[model samples]
Target: MKSLKLISSAIAMLMCFVSMAQERTITGTVTDQSNVPLPGVQINIKGTKNYAQTNYDGNYSIQAKTGDALIFSFIGMDSQTIKVKSSSVINVALKESSNQLQEVVVVGYGESTSDYSTRSYDRAERKKAKTAATASVALQGKVAGVQVQNNAVYNPSQNVVIRGAASVSPKNEPMYIIDGVPAKANQMSKINPNDIKDLKVLKDAAATSIYGNKASNGVVVISTKNELYKNLTEQELDKKLNIMPIPSEPTQEDYDSFVENAFESPRTAPLSTFSIDVDNASYTNIRRFLNNGQQVPKDAVRVEEMVNFFKYTYPQPKNEHPFSINTELNDSPWNSKNQILKIGLQGKNIPTEDLPASNLVFLIDVSGSMSDANKLPLLKQSLKILVNELRQKDKVAIVVYAGAAGMVLPPTNGDEKQTIINALDQLQSGGSTAGGAGIELAYKIASENFIKGGNNRVILATDGDFNVGSSSNSDMEKLIEEKRKTGVFLTCLGYGMGNYKDSKLETLSDKGNGNYAYIDNIQEANRFLGKEFKGSMFAIAKDVKIQIEFNPKQVQAYRLIGYENRKLRPEDFKNDAIDAGELGSGHTVTALYEIIPTGVKSDYLAEQPDDLKYTKTETNSNNYSDELATIKFRYKKPDGDKSIEMVQVIENKAVALEKASDDMKFSSAVAWFGLKLRDSKLVSNKSSEDIKKLAKEGLSNDADGYKAEFIRLVEAVK
Candidate 1:
């Protein structure tokens, strides 16, 4: 009887073991680079519907047989497929997808591959072009859809447009992105083009969709390069040397000579021949001020006005890098006791050892529409400034479109400033506009002189009129879109008034993957071309995008300040190949958000019921410790094969706005400015005066004239 009982027990034990072996339970955890558990991860069999989702702890368990394949997938992460070759338990450490996370762009309502879309010039071409042109002049005629219009003179703020304008308002310019952040349009001039690596324009719906309603105009994505400090070793850092170049000063003799010469020259000129009354007035004034023979105050020469009007060379930033400053005292032509001051300010020397050569073409409009004093004349003046600043290695070409397109000047060395200036001086206005033909000719010239690893850009200046060949807006747009494939960039500058074609200009710039700007005056020109040259020309990042995930428990509602046109969908922020914006060197972008805390006691909303119908019955367990939002940024290097970056945001307890950092304060001020401009009803109890005060407090020590100008503009507008 004992033997029979033992046999039964053995049979039962064997059956239990067989059942357990047939269906084994496997459990494991998944984590990210920070070693933090990733919840809501999807786990499925290689070829079956059997799947399980990870919990908050990133832990998952499933019943499966040995030799099965387990697939793990998550948003903004690459998928992982693991084969169950041995043990039942599996743990996964997912490496973030560099391309997937960094290159994705928000095209209108959809998404596309940003990697495939080629603009006027590629990375190699831009590098080569950078070598040929001065750092300030790096981005001429290189982009297709962009239209760069040089104010016939050396004015800094040339007209820049993206994919043409779609609105009737004067503020139809495309949005600007700097270092993966959206900046105010007027502030675009603050960026230094020389520090940029690449520029990308989001023109078509496919490229601007992520921004939804605000993107109807267009979008620009800028990305800055990583600081070199990341790879520096402690010893190497300690050994780092700083060098600053000091210019020699003029001798006392030189100063005295200049003053003597200045005292001897005549200061006044005859009044305009057309001004009959001015002639009599001048005589009366001369006689009245003679003081028995005091020279009639130099006959009201307007010398001071003229002198003040001219942009005098100002001291540039002195740094250990390549930047330097120089000043000189010249012999004055009209004064004796007072010396004539001449300042020769120099910027950092950009070595061309690894820089690219460039082939640039200027597509100008010599049509009647551009006859405004602020139009053609201003353009001529602006171009002259650029011409004088060109380096020997750069080549420039001129193409005018009016009734027909013609090449006024073939590719020539930038050193021939006089020849270029003469050509600009001789241009005349007549006939209708032929923007299409002009664009074609400009592209052809740029391509003909194409230098490998150089920048090739076509700058178009116009009133956005294309009344001649392929005049239809759509036709011109298609042509630009196709021409961009040839690796050429386009920069559009809008001119004239009343009939200004903001829409067309916006389109050209956006599709060309370049930047756009509006030139309201000469000061604006200097700001664009002179002060922000580095940021305006070189692009360090392209197709950049930003997305923030707000934690519901920590915040009730949040509104992004500015960048109404740059907001992107959560999913579209990860797709590469979607055309975005470009970030220039040394450009700093700021953004702000006003959040309404969940537990705050306020009457901003309508009365609520005591008994909440859909409210949660349980309060958040760790509300104090949870984050409010996660800010994510993605960007590509000027010549890099992919994109990368880090993200940080505020999440702990809600801090008062008054206690925010300096960056936050400046960003909030900018937001206030945008709200005032747009007259947004969503703005809190903030005024322009309040914004100016906040901005003054947070102004950077290195602020050039931007802060002062901001304050002045605020007062003027108010």
Candidate 2:
């Protein structure tokens, strides 16, 4: 009897194994019509909680009985139900719901449908139908509040912005995130649009709060394509992947041709029409001629004329990469009182993947003023270390601007290390700073040997002394501005202690469409060149600008802090030709504002005079009852023919600040820091300690020292 019972049990077990094998499993990716993989898509058995989250790759795998029903549901997509009949592999495409917000929108850490907004775009439903190849093209005018400006120039790195201007601070631009990492917004344009699977803008306070102070401006989230093939086998992944930089360097022949073309003036008149003498001694003589009440000729060495005369030497192109230039306009928002017009410009996009090839023009200020060890001598040693890292393709051109600018070396290649080192060794300190003359000569050399696509930039290492002839800040600015049009980017590397002229260096860099970095030591130089070289060279977007219209009803009063020079007039929004700030690849700009609701019990402002001209209109008590504010932005591509792109955000009830995404929290902390840095009068019940705590909590997976440095900076100021 026992043997018979055991035999029956064994047979039952065998039958169960067969049934399990027959059940089968269906697994695949879910994408929208545009072929963009959809994440957070709900997948479950009908009428059951047996659902799974879409992995980062927008793929899902599940076990199902032969006839079990599987349902797919997404925020803006129509629900899809399929029966697990026979096939073990299944791929699904979802159509957007026509009556509802048909497109799934990515917020900071969540997804939402356009149905939540009254002014959502109708054609967003078709975004998924197109492939990633044409994502930016498809985005032309389809997304409400989203703009894609194309440059007349055909270049890949297009400038993009989210929600218009929110502040007039130095870095009052939106934040950019890649794979959940807070990257620099300027760097995003360098990334191939094809490499991106999805890109979303976080506008309103609700969406941006995850980024906190930084979110006050807005946030852009870019999900790359690599995340989609997470589950594929190594072989399959290899077959589906082709990751390579699009060639951007020009050839040697191309460089020679360009040089030949440049030398041949198109004008029938003499080349003297565009030429001017700007040597330091000549400039000083001209100034002396003027100061002595002597008549100066039209051909006299004026500051502008002198600065424009010298040729700048860019590195010769070793590859097929094209050199580029970018610029931005600095104006107040439509409703502000500041009127300091400014423009920022940058040139070239040096690829980091290539060997360390750079034509570094060191504009050192060795005037009597730079007699300190931390000044001229320190500058020399600091630059020497940078030279040590160069490869054969790299080269260094030393231009000392003190009472005059002169090229220390014509164009020494990196391979001739000893020659370059010897030139540095032979340098000496003397004379006043003929900053104007030095700048002109440096640019002259840079332009003369202009590298077709190599990393050609003028690194101005100085203590900010421009005390010689035509040394005024404005004169220097004008000189840099005119030269920037010629495509030689500039980087102001500030050194020394007192009278550093931080503001002047900042302006030179801004006008030159480059960056200004304060280097107090070797570590700082390494951080700028060694660690952050990619951010320093590759400009993804130029002239990036943002504008925000606050719904008077939602926000009673608001104040933007820090950008005393970048505010734009309301009318500038309609003008697409204006120059603005540029964004480097992976560079992020953050802005902040402290807002006060209408009914909130806070001392925002003193009672205004009833007869005040601008306050004559009755204050609308009904405005802030249901709305907060709206944000808008406008920007141009690095090489686009025209400006394109606009984004908007409407404020909503505040969520749990702690529950906000890392972006929102970190952004807010940044805003707080900015406010403290400027000593903004708008801090509402917030303290420096609070900001620090919030920043610590929102710190993302920051392996680099960026966030930590910010935290430290904030603490130091406190």
Q: Name the top lDDT candidate.
A: 2
Q: Model 2: per-residue lDDT, tens digit, 1-718?
A: 9999999999998887676557444678998887868755667787654654354357765656766788886544677888876677778888865543224354555763232211112322222322212233323334545543322122322234455534322233466666566654324544445466666777767555677765665666666667654444534433444323332221111000000001111111111111111111122223222322233332222222122111122222233322221111121221122111111112234455552356767788888877664566556666766676667877678888777778878778877876676676556678888888888888888877777656677888886767887666678778888988776778777765435555566568767867666565555566556665665555555556656554544444555443434455556654765556655543434444444444444454445335555533443566454444444445555445466654434434544454555554655565454444333444433466777787787677566655655565444333
The segments of candidate 2 whose C-alpha lies over 4 angstroms from its true place after superposition are 1-351, 354-360, 385-395, 414-418, 452-456, 574-577, 606-632, 639-641, 648-653, 684-688, 704-718
Name the 10 consecutive residues with the lowest summed lDDT in model 1.
270-279
lDDT of 1 by residue, 212-293 (tens): 5455556655443443223444334323312122222211100000010000100111010100000011112222222112
Q: After superposition, how far is residue 568 of candidate 2 from its true place, in Å?
A: 1.6
- Clash counts for all predictions: 127, 94
For model 2, state the Cα shift of residue 507 in Å. Answer: 2.2
Q: How high is the lDDT of residue 497 in model 2?
A: 46
